[model samples]
Target: MKPENPLTIGIDIDGTVTEPSSIVPLMNESFGKQLRYEDCIDYNLATVYGISDEVFADWLDKHGERLYDVAPVHGAADRVLRQWYKRHKLVYISAREARHLEVTIKWFSRYQIPYHHMDLIGSHDKLAAARKWQVDLFLEDRLENALQLAEALSIPVFLFDTPYNQGTLPRLVQRVTSWEQVDALVDQLALEKANA
Candidate 1:
């Protein structure tokens, strides 16, 4: 079956549109430990940093605002998203706390990244939001989220490749290294949907 007009695209904020390694410097500075993005083998920061969940949460409480406010957008994300906004419904769905919505919106405005909707779900589970929006495709950075969403929605998930998410993916999940590749894949998917 063909997708509807103005295909709804569910996108992640932190590591997808934003630089995947943006938080490494902040973590190192805050924890007084040397850690690299390449060293992040798992999605859990507590596990990656060898800290308890409570300690990690405390650190975030102290510095999460500044860390998110200054995070850089990924290369070509602004340009590509602006173009996509004209033809597709760009819905940003993130696990960022709802309290950060103001700063998050500010960041988007500061970078001038286009979007039709934004949902700060405060949890890693995004299937609810994806289903609510009827998202046709998902762009993500978390490996498990991508796989889960693909299985739930039976839709293609373009996972922005990062060290934490490096692993084998399901058939519906594709690892993408750049926004340009994302653009190309979206076009290809749209074309296929159109022809189908």
Candidate 2:
């Protein structure tokens, strides 16, 4: 069955649409620390890298734009999002600073990622933005953000699986390993909504 109303999907850009490990190489080269994506068992990179928060913040301040400029899309993300672009409104709600918007937009253009709207909230708290957008579903890579959005918005959230986000999840938050799985789940959701 076709969707009666286009679902507004709130998506996270960095680690959700982009490869979760896409920043690893840049960080490794910048700080001269040998770090692999698998070694990132904690979402807090400062904790994972054993660096002070100030140090990490400084690094991000200096390199965040370039990081966004070069980060690669996650596997199958381009294909899946392009398909959904036809049926739903994809709103990218990211924690990146508003200053990074230009690079972010350029990144999307460079990669041909599809989005109907984009919001760089500049912080991890996205409840307000999600509410404003009236999202029916959300996609995220951060465990905290996923849990918060799922509980607060009462919306189903697809949490992209990452080494860092292995914590227990609430029923509303589903862990997905790839964009292919996400695509299938979205199809199931549309069917369920149609049935209802």
Candidate 3:
């Protein structure tokens, strides 16, 4: 569905919109020391710290559908997302499987998150989707996701600052650790859309 003069906002799941980066820790605990310290999501999912790629993919196949069980990030970030829906079109893009689509959508509904679109994709190339949407701003937690979006020319990814995403911030991205910061971003984006 198209919106009338609505600002397109692309949002990432997992670390960006959710809490504790569930998939990574789950993969690490399941696969053991194989999946280590890799900031990039796809790479880590394919291999484990230079170990066997088969092991990582095998592990991902098992618990990949349980992504919705991952805990949420603290604060009223969902409130911010919902408020933005009042004025803009939010596209929730996740690197998850189709099996978890219903669960993911329910999770958002229970959290009262308002969104216009949702795409449950695998660990494939995400930049393509971001570019296809012509997203004005992207919000995510994974550094690799931010970088990919940035590289795809999707500037100004609103990152949810965390330990995993610290220090190595990209030049074209912005970070926000608190709900207040997200609120500011929502309001600013809303105003811009309204004015335009």
Candidate 4:
């Protein structure tokens, strides 16, 4: 069946909209370690950096806003999101805490990223926010979040492929390699909805 007009699209900010490796430079600079994006086999930077969760949390407390401040936009996200903004309800549902909301908004503004609404739920579990927004579809980069959202919500989720997120996905979760692919998928969904 066709979805409602102006479909609410739940979008993750860090790895989905920004390059998955966006924090590498900050990490490398702070830890004095040279880590490539390929080296990040786990979603947890604490594991990748070989630090305790507490230490990692402290570092994030210090540098989290800065990290978001300088994160680069993922490939073609600005253009494609702008296009989608014309027709869809773009709702950025990020795990970033409310404290970082100002920085996040500034980052979006600095990059000219379009959005109809944004929420920084401060946790990795995005199911609540997604459901609250009544998202028809979701875009994500974390395998766990994508899986949970799809399975629980019974909504299609586009998972942005990353070195850390390598895994088999369920039927409702599709691994997308680029924003271009995401755009194509969105277009296909729109066509399907139209034809329905």
Q: Clash number for every model? A: 0, 0, 2, 0
By descending TM-score, how would the candidates be arranged?
2, 4, 1, 3
* Tens-digit per-residue lDDT, 105-189, candidate 4: 8988988988989999989999989989999899999999999999999999999888999988889999888888888888888
TM-scores for every candidate against the unseen true structure: 0.95, 0.96, 0.76, 0.95
Candidate 1 root-mean-square deviation in Å: 2.5
Model 1, span 1-196: residue lDDT tens = 3336567899999998889889889999878889888999888899998899999989988887898899998989999999888888899999999899899999999998988999999889999999999999999999999999999999999998888898888899999989999999988887877778
Please list the residue runs of candidate 1 whose C-alpha ends up more than 4 Å from where it truly belongs after superposition.
Answer: 1-4
Residue-wise lDDT of candidate 3 within 103-147, one digit each (tens)?
A: 887888888887888877786467877777788888887777787
* Per-residue C-alpha lDDT of model 2 across residues 1-196, encoded as one tens digit per residue: 4447668899999998888998889888887899999999999898988889999999999999988988888999998999998888899999999999899988888888889999999899999999999999999999999999999989999999999999889999999999999999998887777788
Question: How much is 186 displaced in model 1, in angstroms?
Answer: 0.4
Number of the candidate with higher lDDT, 2 or 3: 2
User: Which regions of candidate 3 deviate over 4 angstroms?
Assistant: 1-5, 21-52, 192-196
TM-score of 2: 0.96
